[model samples]
Target: MPMRLTKLLGIELPITQAPMAGVQGHALTVAVSNAGGLGSLPCAMLSADALRNELTAISRQ
Candidate 1:
């Protein structure tokens, strides 16, 4: 069978932690990516400059 979402993501389940900037961190983003499901982030709350920083940091990881 095709890999389920979690297996495809290298995680135990096909779930993601929210990308809550106030609470979530880079570790959470990479973790979800590594685990397979998409991670959530609140880009709307970020200013353009802040978004740039967040994107840059995630890209580096």
Candidate 2:
């Protein structure tokens, strides 16, 4: 059967990494995204500038 999550998220794998604030960043998110899984950026503990920078970094990958 087709995975609902994969179809909904447009990813090959139906895996989602939990957003771990203060423990993870864009690198981990990019890695998961590259591997065809849903990756989350933990924004709760980040400042606006930090979030923007992380977003920029993720986009660059």
Candidate 3:
């Protein structure tokens, strides 16, 4: 069956990587995005520069 969340999110799959404050990093987020899932990156505890770098990395992935 097709997942509505996938359609809504415009992803191939409905999977969403949790935004684990310390655990979710750029690599894991990019990997999940590469696999056609929603990759969530937590920015609450990140420095502005770090978040920018992570965003830049994820955008390239």
Candidate 4:
């Protein structure tokens, strides 16, 4: 069966990695996304430049 959340998010799986503010990063988010899940990038603690870089990294993954 197709996963509902996956369809909702346009991801390959229903899993969603938590946007753990201090612990999650670009590499981890990419890994989760690559594994067919929604990888969340938390921006609450990041500087503008850091968020931009992380977004770029995620896009490249």
Residue-level lDDT tens digits of model 3 in 1-61: 3577788898998788998998778999888888999889999999999999999988887
Stretches off by above 4 angstroms in model 3 are none
lDDT of 2 by residue, 1-61 (tens): 4588789889999888999999999999999999999999999899999999999999999
Candidate structures ordered by TM-score, highest first: 2, 3, 4, 1
TM-score of candidate 3 on Cα atoms, chains taken together = 0.85
Question: What would the TM-scores of all predictions be?
Answer: 0.59, 0.92, 0.85, 0.82
Error of 3 at 7 (Å): 0.8
lDDT of 3 at 53: 96
Model 3, residue 44: distance off in Å is 0.6
lDDT of 2: 0.94
RMSD of 1: 3.7
Error of 3 at 56 (Å): 1.0
Q: 1-61, model 1: which lDDT tens digit per residue?
A: 2357656766565676765757665667876776766776667778888888877888898
For the record, the alpha-carbon RMSD of candidate 2 to the native fold, in angstroms, is 1.2
Give lDDT tens digits, candidate 4, residues 1-61: 4676778888998788999998879888888888898888899999999999999988886
Write the number of the candidate with greater lDDT, choosing between 2 and 4. Answer: 2
| Maximum-lDDT candidate | 2
Q: Would you list the C-alpha lDDT of every candidate in the order shown? A: 0.70, 0.94, 0.89, 0.86
Q: Which 10 residues in a row give candidate 1 its minimum summed lDDT?
A: 1-10
